[model samples]
Target: MDDKKLVKTLFMVMTHRNEQVGLSLWNDNPQGYNQYCQWQTIIANPRAMGLGKRYIESDLNRSFNIPNPRTYEEKRA
Candidate 1:
């Protein structure tokens, strides 16, 4: 099947897990803003296709607001 067909199949079957709504961060610098948008797109679409960026044990979505992070993932927050 083609890429579009694969994406459609994934969406229809609901096999994806921990799928959160895509969020784009704001960047003050023009170049930085563009880069942020690009990165967000890169990460979001793959997850939409059932390819999550982080392992099932880690939740990148929850990493951002963490305080005094301990694990590598928390520090990555």
Candidate 2:
């Protein structure tokens, strides 16, 4: 099979979950998608694999150069 044919034959799926928001997926159907299922398993058990947890009070994207860092959040900036 050509590249296009092979790609078409393969099954693909993507899923995401946000605590503040909700669950989402690119392919709503997951039946017979072994690779996709394996990926979800890894994501679900991230802590078991030594992954870091998300910050609660502060956003990592907001930290940048500032004249004065007064508060704990500011110091992180």
Candidate 3:
């Protein structure tokens, strides 16, 4: 019921299933989380929705701070 206990329980469950509740390098989970945040905020602009925005490189982390980068804060600004 408490946040700690809930997190522990979730962690155990995820660990048992070889799943992670956090970002995964193979799945661009960071970008996914960023986009999800953008959707929930007023900063949910076209750029936030994966529009006009270009990822010159396919690296999400690299794209994380490219001036008009695509990270959670950028999207949720």
**Candidate 1 TM-score, C-alpha based:** 0.28
Clashing pairs in 3: none
lDDT of 1 by residue, 1-77 (tens): 24333321111111123444332221222122232232212232334335543433345456567767765445544
Query: Each candidate's lDDT (Cα)?
Result: 0.35, 0.31, 0.29
* CA RMSD (A), model 3: 12.8
Would you list the rank order by TM-score, best first?
1, 2, 3
- Cα-lDDT of candidate 2: 0.31
Tens-digit lDDT track of model 3 for 1-77: 34333321111111111223331432342222232231111122323224434222242333334567455434333
Q: Candidate 3: misplaced stretches above 4 Å?
A: 8-49, 52-54, 61-77
* Residue 70 lDDT, candidate 3, scale 0-100: 58
- Write the candidate numbers in order of decreasing lDDT: 1, 2, 3
Instruction: Report the lDDT tens digits of candidate 2 across residue range 1-77.
Output: 24333322332211112231211332333333343232221122122123233433343345346576553334544
Q: Candidate 2 — which residues are off by over 4 angstroms?
A: 1-53
